[model samples]
Target: MSPIKNPTTFFAYIRRAPFGGRLTQGQIDGVNAILDAWEYFKLTDHRWLANILAQVFHETGGRILPVRETFASTDKAAIANLEKAWKAGKLSSVKTPYWREGWFGRGQIQITHKANYLKLGQRLGVDLVKNPAKTLDPVIGARIAIVGMAEGLFTGKKLGDFFSHNTDDPVGARAIVNGSNKAKLIATYHKAFLDAIEAARGAVDAADALPEAAIADDVKPAESSTVMSLLGGTVGTAGMSALLGVNNPWGFGIAALVLLLGAGAGYMFLSGRWSVNRIKGHA
Candidate 1:
């Protein structure tokens, strides 16, 4: 059996190498809640989880972008205009002279480009072009990213199905994400996705076994008591009496004497004669 079948081992994998970076307690809780929701939504595959993590890590250096004050003012209208520029090809000039062009693609997963943000925001019930900072929230970012991954850029094809369909097409969506070395990146992402699935399966199996395990634990004491009673009945009725005679008669006698003395004192107290004499003398 794979160690991943064990919940403890599976959680150890998560604790050692969680997707996001330097998560606070609250962030970790949020991440766990997201994972639970994903499981509830039947998205429990480790590969998908890891892919999301890698995408976010690659985009935002694993740090959540400040909501209102990272690249510019958190103005919804301004963000919408930026998207309009990207779709119009007016903002194609890499004026910043860095890796990518503009600064609007700022978040955990970097929801870049204006059109994508508008689409994702609409699906996630947020005004992405306006409150771009909402994408920095891990839960919102993960949900939007998942939606985008499942549903392509304004296309109806699921991203996974699309990649599989265009595995041989050099200019496909996969190629756009990974560039010239798209095959290698796709393979890596695919592996991460598979790992996430296996981990999630293990977690489910472990959860299913929990009730049975609890029942077994509860039954153990009863079994132990039965065995003890049998042993005691046999021993007390047979060889134990003989062994007690030989083991230390004097010590047993001393214990009996101590017990008798304790009983005699208790009897005297119960009789209440001393207490009665004191009470009568005081009166």
Candidate 2:
């Protein structure tokens, strides 16, 4: 089963953005781009997907598309602070294009500074140092955001640091991108997205299991203890209680079918066989 059941269903879930605004077509496209990149980049873990999307949504403030950093127009105080740091020699005062030429904070994840841009550009085979405007492109921005976050490029706080099957700290996940800034807010979005994605995942798995279910329906077991033996005496006793309730043959048959399904699902769940092997099959 794929991480997403259907794009429509996924979009429907995404419409519940925290800020309570409608998503534009471009924003939807950007989301699709992000999902595609996740698959392409092999970050298909549902937990990771939920956390990543939450961070992205929080960063963009319900905007569908990845946007360039607007600190120049919106926050002169920050730029002045950076300038002050530069003057004090606490940070490099290199007057590159990104510093003076409006190339600063151009990616969805907002990779700032000329040196960082040059490094990321070299890694991705794009000349961000020369054409820093490319970071504003949604596709490029998605790639940068996806790869950067997953790999812990943002202040060495990788996605793996806070996400795993056994443990998930959505608020702490903010550390993966920006060191506890808006951690709780992003965590709220994370839980919402996680619920949506898990629902979609269950839907996809149920859909995929239909054929197997049909096959099970076709095979009616004999009047023997084989199923009971396989299911163990305790489980078989409980199943028999349900199976023996019906007086009519048709009702009995339906009850038996239900037991068979329950047994199959229980076995799969206990043996850890039900989940799709996404890592093995998908890149």
Quick one: best lDDT, which candidate?
2
TM-score of each: 0.44, 0.61
Q: Give the per-residue lDDT digits (tens) of candidate 2, residues 197-240.
A: 76556444333222111111122322223233333443476787
Candidate 1: minimum summed lDDT over ten consecutive residues — where?
A: 209-218
lDDT of 1 by residue, 1-283 (tens): 2223443223323333433212233333334434543554466434445554444333443332323213445555446656666667876764442212333554444555667678888877788777666776766765765666555543443446533533422124343234333445444544543454465455343432221121112223223222223233433444333333422323433433354455567667888844445445654
Q: What lDDT would each prediction earn against the true structure?
A: 0.44, 0.65
Show how many residue pairs clash in every candidate, following the order shown: 11, 1
RMSD of each: 20.7, 17.8
Quote the positional error of residue 177 for candidate 1 in Å: 4.0
Error of 2 at 11 (Å): 1.2
Off by over 4 Å in 2: 19-21, 71-98, 202-283
